[model samples]
Target: MQVNLPTNLLRSFVAIADTGSIVRATDKIFLTQSALSLQMKRLSEIVQVPLFRREQGTLVLTVSGERLLDLARRILELNDQAVESLDSVGLNGPVRIGIVQDFGDEILSGVLARFIQLNPGAELQIRVGHSREIRELFATHLIDIAVYHSVERDEFTVAPARMVWLGDPRLADRETLPLAFMTKPCLARDCAIAALEGAGRPYQLIVETSNISALRVAVEAGLALTCRSSAFTGHRLPAVELESLSLPTYFIAVMTLPSAHAAITGLAALITEAIENIVSPPFDLATDCPIKETEDA
Candidate 1:
């Protein structure tokens, strides 16, 4: 019995597998839950096996489903590559972009709008997450490009900037404070810890969260303090001073797979130029040096 599967159905299956829920997958693919469910059902019927089982209100992929997930991803990736080859001829394909949440709304929104206008044929699939998660997306070939805080990886290109500590005005006077931080492997978390350790300033870990919004909420509520790039703090939260922690310059980078398409390269160039223009006239390191004494003296 030969059964044919639709590309949209397979794509929905992959989304459901990746997200583990119809609602979440629908959000990812911009499909309704009912539509996604119908696709899943059609897919199961075609494959002659149950793809997912509901347990504890979550969808769990069965063994057959797990096997199909890998194949579906490869098939879809190949299809995308074919479309991208056609896109290179005329510049008309989706460019998956991953961005860190810290780049304030205004800058990100404006940049994206301009990018869209600049390349009308290109569609942008934007994902907002921490630098690490974004990196994973890039590594897994899920996203074509990423703009995120630089990780200590030899593979990525670095764009360095001055790091700053941001906190509520209420916590500005406190000496030994509780710190709010994201999960491990985050560049911001690493920089925050390194700054505290370098300064010999002891701090308590008040809240450890993976959510950027939640971290901001904790910091605003005086539950903890956080370290982020100054660019991120510009217009998002309340005005906060960077009086305590004197951290060295940090970096964020735009990364893409080495074998990515020419359109990806073009988009990366556009994003890099925009970010560099915004963060230019970087901190001057030459002024810190002492004046040399004259030879006659």
Candidate 2:
């Protein structure tokens, strides 16, 4: 039987195999588990071979799956190269993008790498700082695009991130939690403090720096705990054990001015597409994560 597999399906297959779990794979591919499963099923039907086998609670590739892996990767490489070569024609000039420090360090490198690979001639000026500063850069027209987290629904949201407490385990048992965070104009800091106060839980700000690196250092050294998105914190630090601590959801958003040039707009679309593929899955393109043009607010 002739076999035909879509590029997206192959991408999902490669992601699932690489990540080793549906949850982590979904996060990498930015697809719902159901959606991913559906793609797998369709691929299997086309190939007439089982691709995955459950072994000791792990998803293992079948022999056929293993054989297809190499082919799939090569095909995808060629496909993407052709697409980039075609799409990148005449796409030149610098694209200034501002991003929050925490989120910037996590996804910026990979995002920019892919973008640069596609637009080889394009120049990238990446400015990393606090979310407030990033927003200010956008407002001043210093940046063509801005990626930051917000509590308010004023911008084009890319995804919803769960805010959680993270710190060294040694500091998790404190009666009055020691907080380490960026100074004023930080939504996560404000949200964490509000939650603690609302729960009548005592806490103190032990470290208030202008960046996430210092906050991360403090948290890693058992100096204090801080609130950040799972996207930002990842599993690098343990989540602070606090049954009483309730935090708010943060929106990872893309901000662009209405007067942005076509190149800026195209770059923004690339960013949106890249973010959708990299962020944790179960995203709804219609409501949960709206990737559209919006005026800077």
Q: Which ten residues in a row have the lowest lDDT in candidate 1?
A: 282-291
Question: Against the hidden true structure, what lDDT does model 1 obtain?
Answer: 0.72
Off by over 4 Å in 1: 1-8, 14-82, 87-93, 104-108, 118-123, 151-158, 197-202, 205-207, 217-224, 235-244, 280-297
* Candidate with the greatest lDDT versus the true structure: 2
Model 2: C-alpha RMSD to truth? Answer: 16.4
Question: Residue by residue across 180-203, what tens digits does model 2's lDDT show?
Answer: 888888888889888888888888
Candidate 2 Cα lDDT to native:
0.75
State the TM-score for model 2. 0.60
TM-scores, all candidates, are: 0.65, 0.60
Residue-level lDDT of model 1, residues 7-56, one tens digit each, is 67888888899888999885456567998888888899888999999989
Candidate 1: the clashing residue pairs are 161-250
What is the TM-score of candidate 1? 0.65
